[model samples]
Target: MAGSTFVIAGQNAIRRFKPKDHIFETLATHVDQEMLNKPNDLAFDALGNLVFTCPGNSRQEPTGYICALQPDGRVTKIPEHMYFPNGLAFAPFEDALIIAETYRHRLWKGHWNASALKWEDAHPWVEVGGPIGPDGMAFDQAGNLYVAIFDQAQIKQINPQGEIREVYPLSGRRPTNCAFDLSGKHGLIVTEAERGEILSLSVDQPGFPLFRGNNGWK
Candidate 1:
């Protein structure tokens, strides 16, 4: 939970739900005064700026992009021509951001410029080759990344050195996203699409604590 508001991304807009008021407020519809093609997934930087992937409708073409919502209510886009940018997360170490390009079956990890509030140098860090759908991911305290493979019916653990450490097969076919129980007792709580189920897997260590940021939604 980043900040007090529940942030949602989809339907060409980024909305926030304030539990206290029980209302959904639109944070961004059009970035830079233009309609968002299709906002897919979102995450927060070390500074709390809201970042998301927008693949639009061009799944077969390289037209996907990324955007960020500033704390002061501003939206900025990081333009790129990639297959399909699906999910993203801020690296717990090295002030980096890792993004999933689903169609290409690749993950790009890049360092960011804190002062400029932008990505500096990002390149292909690893390949999740199989069905071309690396959906959601999270990092453990031991520096392993658990990625829910969309069509592979499994979860992969990527080590800190950017290698496939292990693979945990799932009963559900299409695992979409995952997160760890804050208390580290429930292991990894994963959501799936094919069977519409929530699965939990025991692991070696607890996940790195997620940030409750006040940067973007300040």
Candidate 2:
């Protein structure tokens, strides 16, 4: 997985792609529909377990949940019901996993238990303001969290203390997610879902490099 890219499809499936040869292979399929109706964002824990968010229908109820796919093909649902789990990320120090609850307009944190292979101490990390929902998140080297505000077409920079420090307006509409490029020029790349485009912007800070194990999926 070191040289390959992983992609999540709409039909509850995950795929791996080799860019050099343009070859794609189905990595996992038929993910539990009840627990993972809509797999939104994914991240890896310190132990390399696949953590993903399933933001179920927001109009119905708070049915969304966070799930972890173990290396041995077992799926464990984190014991929490979120309104709309959209984005996911692990702390730079691998201390906690951060989640964005879109409909609730807040970020949540959960600590990992390596021995038990579970998450604990789940709590609210930050309360995002405004009518727009937080969709995706990325961290800078200085531990600043960048959140993509979907409805407002804006991005918010939140400090480690969970305070909004700055907001940047974007030309794209309905921005779905964002990621910072650690290599090359160190720019922020955002996905304009509605417009079907990708936007790149230069930032003052570089992104924190994510830890990748020898297995490569992380």
Candidate 3:
């Protein structure tokens, strides 16, 4: 029963939506007019506020920022300045938000407190891919960060203590997003490019595709 809102950087306006009906709510059109135009991924904080990447349109977009949609429908920007920030997650144990920097090939950390919105203690948390673009991310029950790497065509597993534990490469050229099965024994992966299909991989084994689809909405 979560509410919906669409927010971009520099835009104070909030657009709400209903997923079930696939329609916009009353405040669907009001948006911030002063923020950056291009935003990347969308995530949520512990309080359920919407958070997303405001990468703008250039790699030079100064110190990337993450926008939080407040309960009042106002979007607040947190300037983090992590290179091309993408996927994001809150590390409960650390009380901080972990963000993946696509162009920097690393992860950045920020405190979760309300006052942490401004970039102050922001710093690199973990490095990934020797030279690959890290995109979508997810954390396993063990707190292992799984990164969908582009160009390299692999999923990198970074352990809780900041270690490159494993690499799961796919036969497909590019893997976009990923989700673990309830049992944690299998994974479902989405490939943004290549036109048609999701690559399913077994956790026990790596670099193999179990099944694929025709890129259908169904």
Q: Over the stretch 131-202, how does candidate 1's per-residue lDDT look in tens digits?
A: 757989998887789998889998999987899989999998799899899797789999999999998899
Task: Estimate candidate 2's alpha-carbon lDDT, on a 0 to 1 scale.
Answer: 0.76
* Worst lDDT 10-window in candidate 3: 209-218
User: In candidate 2, what are the lDDT values of residues 77-145, reduced to their tens digit?
Assistant: 775567888888887765777888888778888787754667789888888764757888888888888
- Clashing residue pairs in candidate 2 are none
Per-residue lDDT of model 3, residues 76-118, tens digit only: 7776455677777765345566787888778887677654444
CA error at residue 97 for candidate 3, angstroms:
1.0
Error of 3 at 33 (Å): 4.0
Predicted structure with the largest lDDT when compared to the true one: 1
Off by over 4 Å in 2: 19-23, 30-35, 184-186, 215-218
lDDT of each: 0.82, 0.76, 0.62
Return the candidate ranking by TM-score, descending. 1, 2, 3
Better candidate number, 1 or 3, judged by lDDT: 1
Q: TM-score: which is higher, 1 or 2? A: 1
Query: Where does candidate 1 stray beyond 4 Å?
Result: 1-3
